[model samples]
Target: MTGYTCTSCGEHHEELPFAYSAPAPAFWQDAPTDVLEPERCVISGEHYFLRGRLVLPVRDADQDFEWGVWVSVSKDNFFRAEELWDDPKRTDEPPYFGWLATELPGYEPGTLNLKTNLHTRPPGERPLIEVEPTGHPLAVEQRDGITLIRVQAVAELLRHP
Candidate 1:
């Protein structure tokens, strides 16, 4: 595959990054230092968050684009997920309602606090985040799909931003 020139760094990357990730939820990032936890994927206590992937089909490519983001879930759901964390049957669990907790770049209205459903997968896979059906650009892209040009634009934006 051909590489892309990173506008931000003024360097050429060997390949476009098909997935972008947030180390933690925006809330956790902005929280008081005392409330921060060391865990990268799950945050417990007053607020609960779980990292998941929001996948969007690339209309002109064979692979999908993924946003490795976090979503805020209820305490109960958080605990339940923890209990089933290593269970292969965890995939049978019902999807949990959550608020999108990562603010993705390149969207005008912003990608924070959007309604979502976190669907658990098997033991080794991250939960899949399903954005609620809406007129939001991200949601539309999730439902309809994006072209290779759009994916390249996103790669450039995320790489530079």
Candidate 2:
């Protein structure tokens, strides 16, 4: 199977399914309302930032895992995403583009500056992000159409001025 070569880790991957600010999974029903809400992708100035958990499907391993991601979205792509999020009927759009601001783990919150291209998958498949991480990662939890993610961890990333 031909796969995409990851720019971050220099590994060829056959499948890397990821999700953005998707609806929460069923297990997250007991979470606080705020925690159960889908994390918003915010645009500041010309860049967009999102703090949330992404579900990455490992085809070879036959399992899926979650990672806390912080992304800086491109201006044009951010606008496209806004449009898609606002208009549920517009599902034929292209994937949005952004940069992975930090590696999956190891560095302190504000120190890591790992820059890598991150693109959203086409609508309907949980918006896959294609990349690998070093160190420990988070887990995916969703319920009632909201993603139970690291709200505080992601908030710190956006709080930077």
Candidate 3:
């Protein structure tokens, strides 16, 4: 259930079914056990569930896009980090750290982590970040430093992020 190749109808689909791209990747956290990276949304092939810490779908909040799902680690390390970037360095050009403010240095707070999956249970099953309040303010803030998050619970968690 994972054959891809359709940057918008190139044709080669297989099991596509992913939909979560907005503003939800500050470093989400929920590591207990994961490893299932299976992306496939080049143009609606769908199939996106990367594991490591990806709960994408945040057309608001702070920002969450560019490979995700990795905290406990599942989604098969999100397809083994894209099969190790599918060799050839996948064109290389990542690892940067210049912009993105709101206190994004080491990302502190136990080490880069942000999460959301509200079904109703902000007590502690996870998903209630907002600086840990259990009140789902949809956190991630800094202001002067830049980092600012809180766009209506990630725009309603992007419908189903």
Candidate 4:
């Protein structure tokens, strides 16, 4: 009944908009040299620094989940994830950083859609679905480098933010 306008149907409803928020770097190829606080990797046995932000959902229904950016290092690898950045502003076990020892060339930041797939894993449920970035940053670092585009913490995203 107030301050709510639909983008497609032109319907008026009452709800807070800013539900989903993403890192949204100006361009995919641009990034800051230093984004994260210095930290040691538990997996790679190396010292690395990183920074990142979460890509929030565009809809209020999607805001059910907490959101933010994440960049951390462990013995295994240095990581920057957009989807998993939950708002400890509410829960525990923030999986902010975790991975096996490995090396990452780097990545470009952008928004992504979360989905579900029933083809793999524990069955009955399709976990996080990460569609490739149409506005990717400088191609997925050399073909061999492998760009691990993934989506996780979906249910959570639909539960908190």
Q: Rank the candidates by lDDT, best first.
A: 1, 2, 3, 4
How would the candidate models be sorted by TM-score, starting from the highest?
1, 2, 4, 3
Q: What is the C-alpha lDDT of each candidate?
A: 0.85, 0.42, 0.29, 0.26
After best superposition, candidate 4 residue 130: deviation in angstroms? 22
lDDT of each residue in 72-128, candidate 4, tens digit only? 334222332222223232122223232111112123343221111111112222112
Best by TM-score: 1
Top candidate by lDDT: 1
lDDT of 4 at 131: 25
After superposing candidate 2, which stretches have Cα over 4 Å from the reference?
1-38, 41-44, 51-53, 58-62, 89-91, 106-126, 132-161
Off by over 4 Å in 4: 21-67, 70-72, 76-161
lDDT of each residue in 91-147, candidate 2, tens digit only: 555544545554443235432333334444444433444333433232222211122
Q: List, residue by residue over 1-161, the lDDT tens digit for candidate 3.
A: 34445444456645433323322223323344422233211112222232222233345434442223222222343344446544544234232111111122222343233342211111222211122223222233321111113222232333334
Q: How many steric overlaps are in each model, in order? A: 0, 11, 37, 31
Candidate 1 to truth, TM: 0.87
Q: Residue-wise lDDT of candidate 1 within 1-161, one digit each (tens)? A: 47776666788888877888887888664534324333233443477888899999998888999999989899899889989989999999999999999999999799999999999999878899999999999999999999877877888886666
For each candidate in turn, the TM-score is 0.87, 0.40, 0.19, 0.21
Cα RMSDs, all models: 2.8, 14.5, 18.0, 17.6
